[model samples]
Target: MFAQALRDILQPLPPKCDIPQDEQLQEAMNTLEVIVSLLLKEQFDTWRYEALDGILLTVAQRRDADTAFFGGDCILITDQTVSPIEVEVTLGGGGAGLVRVCCRVGEKQDGKLMRHSYDKEHRYRTLIWQERDPHHELEWMYFVERMYDENGR
Candidate 1:
């Protein structure tokens, strides 16, 4: 059911010149709704409403607004409401066929980053994490464990 919905939402559309700009905007809006709905199911406390403008601005970056694709970063507050998980979304040119959503979890100070991206060609999601100090990777692991533990409490 979820897969079908995603497929429908991301289905290719007619060329930008073929469709009206308003219709293109509507299509982008619909895609945004689905993305937000999926994100809400996660453990984030809340999404920052002000960040939405950034997404629109990204879409408007191109000279031709109708053909402009979306690319922007938004923050999802952690369950404890002390930190933020950044989600960066980018769509392929002309607004359909390919999409990339990257989520960064953990702290910059600790030198840990988690990236999650969906590959349209492969039809799969990939999760990759990096740590600066390989020798002390366990510290980063414990940090995440403690964060979840605290959130659970």
Candidate 2:
């Protein structure tokens, strides 16, 4: 499922003239929904949330390269009384995709959110394009778990 969804996003669309930009955006958004859904179920399910705001996916053409990359963030609505937790995902462009997933699981303290001594980050590289990649799944799980721990949740 992960590989298929990633492939849908990574696959090149019909050239700009052939496909409308809005259509491409919709397609990417759909694929991103699938990706984030998978991550939520497989990685961050342990974190209880009353609701999840829609994932925000951003895709941009790389100025320095031919390939484009994607980045996204989702707010997990944990408790109505507190601020939502934010989880972000960044995907790099290439035949071998690289993903960075992290989460901020805390309320603002001293005008800073999760301003801690340790920087919890996870980086993973896919084995190949359009292939099942567990590297990213593991990285995402580790990132969320670490963030949850750091936040004393």
Candidate 3:
């Protein structure tokens, strides 16, 4: 039920729309971060944000997989996954432009469990936050849906 509701809310934009200006892009990322933080807090009282680079490289060696982290460049590493359905909340930048919040999917090479810079072009879904709506009605849904989908629970 939640998945269906979330999917309905995160419908992607039309293919030819213009990219948002820098200010708008910043606003979208901020809004996305806040929404994700709130929802995750509601779902898990222990929710927290760690740095993806640091966590992947060091801290995660002795940490739990359910830990949440801010993956720099507006990406949130929701440490929840199952093989091919790894999920991350990437907002703006990273060649993805500013209008949409991306829910990217990729498999770790050689079944390896390490973080290294790599291209993400395999598969992704996104939700365009409508700049016209200051209330941010639609932007919140993508986090919920993608979190659920990528976590695959």
Best by lDDT: 2
Predictions in order: lDDT: 0.31, 0.36, 0.29
Q: Better model by lDDT, 1 or 2?
A: 2
- Separate clash counts for every candidate: 0, 0, 1
Model 3 lDDT per residue over 1-153, tens place:
322222222233332232323443334334444554555455544345521211111000101111111222223355432111112332222222222223322223554332323224111211111122335322221233333323332
Clashing pairs in 1: none
TM-score of each: 0.26, 0.32, 0.28
TM-score between candidate 3 and the true structure: 0.28
Residue 32 accuracy (lDDT) in model 3: 46
Candidate 2 residue-wise lDDT, 1-153, digit = tens? 332333344455532222223555555545544444444556555543433333333223322222334333333444322222334433344433324444433344554432122112211111121243425432122234222222222
* Candidate 1, residue 53: lDDT: 18
Clash number for candidate 3: 1
How many residue pairs of model 2 clash at the backbone?
A: 0
Candidate 3 Cα misplacement greater than 4 A, ranges: 1-15, 44-46, 49-143, 146-153
